[model samples]
Target: MLEIGLTMKKLKLKESTCAICLTAMKAGQGHAIFTAECSHSFHFHCITSNVKHGNQICPVCRAKWKEIPFQNPASDISHGRQRINAVGWPRDDTWMTVLRRLPPARLDTNRHIPSLYHAQEPPIFDDDETLDQQHVIAERDVSIIDGVGDPNSVGTIEIKTYPEVSAVSRSASHDNFTVLIHLQAPVTSGRHSGSSNNAELPQMSQNSRASVDLVTVLDVSGSMAGTKLALLKRAMGFVIQNLGPSDRLSVIAFSSTARRLFPLRRMTEAGRQEALQAVNSLISNGGTNIAEGLRKSAKVIVDRKWKNSVASIILLSDGQDTYTVTSPNGTHPRADYKSLLPISIHQNRGTGCQIPVHSFGFGTDHDAASMHSISEISGGTFSFIEAEGVIQDAFAQCIGGLLSVVVQELQVKVECVHRNLHIGSIKAGSYRTSITGNARMGTVDVGDLYAEEERDFLVTINIPVDRSIDQMPLLKVGCVYREPITKDAVTLEGASQVWIQRPEIIGAQVVSMEVDRQRSRIHAAEAMAEARVAAENGDLARAVSVLESCYKSLSETASAQTGDRLCVALCAELKEMQERMANRQVYETSGRAYVLSGLSSHSWQRATARGDSTDSTSLVQAYQTPSMVDMVTRSQTMLLGNPSSHRKLRQALSFPAARPQPR
Candidate 1:
């Protein structure tokens, strides 16, 4: 028997003696006996099947076996506490030991980052004179965001490629290229996250003449009494510092009830001092009322002064919204606090405002699910501060030190009308997508790509091996978006051809190692999936071995290709997963952690988006917290009593049901 600390000699069983069923016993996710206290043991399949058929009584003893505890003189830990604790896997020697096998998190910023792009020299293409033409087709599919919003906001969509992968494939077979549909902008990190801030945010407007109206909602619950509150106010100073002369400011403080420090007003010297005084006078006393705080902030945005201004709500909270635990889903309002979405939605219609909520989750005790859902549903950004100590850091990350911060919603769609080749599927890191048009088209929720920040989707094209490639246009990729400053519809298109020839004659060469670097997450995901089938079939050893092997192969591939960012994600997640499998943490019930892994791919990228940063691997660990998945799993009452159902394989071509969507 698979053992943890149980000392009882395992009961020997015949192949035909399953305690739940009268049939033979099998091995895998849940394949064993349930010997609690009985002389005539029954098949586990028989017992469980009978119980589900409304027979809790043991067939042999006719006793109440439903709630009985099973043990062999000693019992394995309950499923809930299997190999983890409240915060997740114990942060001990075992965890650290697993981390040591991977490459160093990151090299010195100067060395790995600057030199990282040094290899990106322009390819000497003979000439663009012979290139094929692609038709420019722009379609404004749908606008989820309402109102005639942000006049100054313009969006520009560029379908471009890195210099390395820009060349048309002239090789005879197995040729590939990556075209990036830059939805928004490349994401950067906090001031010190090692980012040089290169990518410009396309349509998120930062109009100099437009007045800024930002309302910061602060949580002054008892939990914020000591160091938390002090650091919180200090962080608020950064927001105040970012305000321009024409900018407006408002502060909404909430504990049991909400109260505005000042009415919606422009930020002047006197106004700044008054806001500062209110922040200093703030004290902690009542329960957390984040809902009320957000509700009040919404009102501040509705005031006349905010019309046509750069409006936003900076929501900071260190606890769950008052009594919000009873809410069905954080997407809707509850008795404790108002749901931010209803207000955001109500305000987005007609003359109402369309301000984005920038949420900061502070302290270890904060409710991440609620915060994340609120930010996502309300079309705002969410950030986890880790602790009160990093208040300033979180503020800088969520709001930034830039004189102006622009926010916009981005949507991308790829269509394949060609008969020979078609786009199979798109893996948009952690973004959410809906497949429509009979698999011929897909719409991606790219959210907001912050200034100097970038997001990408992988286009998997189904190519025919036997098809003749006679310089025919194989794929035509295009992008449609509104420009950032002009608010005009901007669309771009690019085309590439296919030619059948031997690889050597075309003088094929290795290009930038950084091309398609984000694919590392996708590759590891593929490998992890392969290992899961083996584990569910009672081959735990094979599962661990396969996963470990996949990790090493990925590590080698990333290293040889110089996929620095992708390498970090692979090493960090693969090793951690290997440890989990080895310790039997990923037992029978759940074959793999795809839902969590899917969410993590984006989190890891966000953490390392800035150059010279590797701590994001740890961020990936947090995103895939064993408990995090368990919480989401248990949230659905259907899986509460039936734990094994979580292992059901999702449709092969479908996206993960649960996605960590960022606004």
Candidate 2:
């Protein structure tokens, strides 16, 4: 898949050559040639026509275009970039805007929490200049939200969250009401893949544009010579151009060494142009030094301008740390780039601040193993862009998703008021946790809550009721999070109860289908994890048996339910997936694919699931891989942080170049 042996060279454009339009260059029509480090020539219209296509790799030599007119060390001072993509301190004072503080909340006895706000502005940006307003940073950080529809309005997925459910049973059993969550996306009726099954995907509603502080860390090394570097530039373009005026951005490029392209600045017209120029001037050479780039990223991220913004770092790397240097003084031991992993995470995890580093591994040459671990430990998401073109899509999706965040740093606490009840499990967002300390308390760290993104979490509780026929409170849920717009702390609480019945009656209530679906997903994920472990240990038989048996059992259960078409197909897919495990095909990909897919697949096993329909409602476009089908959609919005790594099926799963969906 890798086209190698090409060197960066000079371009001598002839009238008959074109890289993009594939036609001859015309006189006076102009032509564009990447003359610095590449010899690709094309029609000017054909070449410059596309900015963020992620296809900037030279067609003739497969060389990626280096940003034009690379800045010298001294000359970069004027551009506010310390080195490559990193930002330097600005000379102007326009960026010193003030942020206003919120007033007291009005009391309302009817609602326990009283009033929060009409709309919270992003605390990072400034609406006024010079002096700090009622506070620091921005005066009034108002966000503009257009009409957005729920993904459920058209999606086949059925996500149901039960605050409380009936616990009445004829038999005298433990009566406990646990929070039930379900994410069901039916697929059978939409098996006609050629047609647009827009209904199969959820359209996110509640479009709100908020400010963000994003620092892009790029790997412009020899390994990233071709399409990798090209796509990264294209993706960076997507992120920079679509940034809100209040957003703060910086760029960092690293190969043998690291360089900051620009200093952290607001996304005004000048700032955007400067940032794009930096992106355009980048070139691939030397070797990878990821830690160096990350270190520079930390420098740009700590800026006061982005203090209240939804801040994060985007890292694009194709290889491991292939280059390290010894200390010049000879008094100190040489440093390993791998050792910088913890240091990089610690940089953002200082005090009360955290800068989630969304990392992307480019291709076969990429160091995905380390990159993904960094993302997980740092509480940031990980992604891989297969080869080329998908880079821009990944960026668009990631930025778009970050922009659509409804709340950040979600901390959920679950407590039980009822006696003799033990919490079995608690699911929140994409992660599920079990209560450890006491049956009374459990906590879940939900990273981000997206607009119209319904994450149905289930809390399974085991109740041992001897014989109390009275009704009582069973469960309590508490949530603490920063307001999406204002970045102020907010707490929300809710409680649910259940009734116990006589133990010796007939006809016990059937558990909700949604609950069963979620439970099934958990079991499937366990199987996948186990299978992965087995395969890694060279126990091919065990791995195959694990997946195959789980698939068979799932199929039997699904067959009992209506609409087995999708289920049957999934079972077949599982069979194929099981074979993949036996042959060692998909081990390197995401370990949580089963969990993410189960969120959708098991929903069909539940009743009240939607039948396929035709309703196209556009909403927030966040790149998420639920299954192979949804995975293919990754190409369109490819927002950089994709964790899965499918090697052989790259073309089938990869997305096209991306564009921003306006909020």
Candidate 2 Cα lDDT to native:
0.48
Q: What are the per-residue Cα lDDT tens digits for candidate 2 across 447-503?
A: 554443344466767665444554545566666666545455666564233333334
Per-residue C-alpha lDDT of model 1 across residues 52-105, encoded as one tens digit per residue: 434333333232232432312222333233522222212111100010021222
Q: Which stretches of candidate 2 lie over 4 Å from their true place?
A: 1-41, 44-178, 181-208, 303-306, 323-339, 342-352, 427-437, 470-472, 495-504, 558-560, 564-663
In the order shown, the candidates' Cα RMSDs to the true structure are: 24.6, 16.2
CA lDDT scores, all candidates in order? 0.44, 0.48
Off by over 4 Å in 1: 1-158, 162-212, 302-305, 308-310, 327-356, 379-381, 401-407, 430-442, 465-468, 483-485, 493-516, 523-553, 558-563, 573-663
Error of 2 at 235 (Å): 1.7
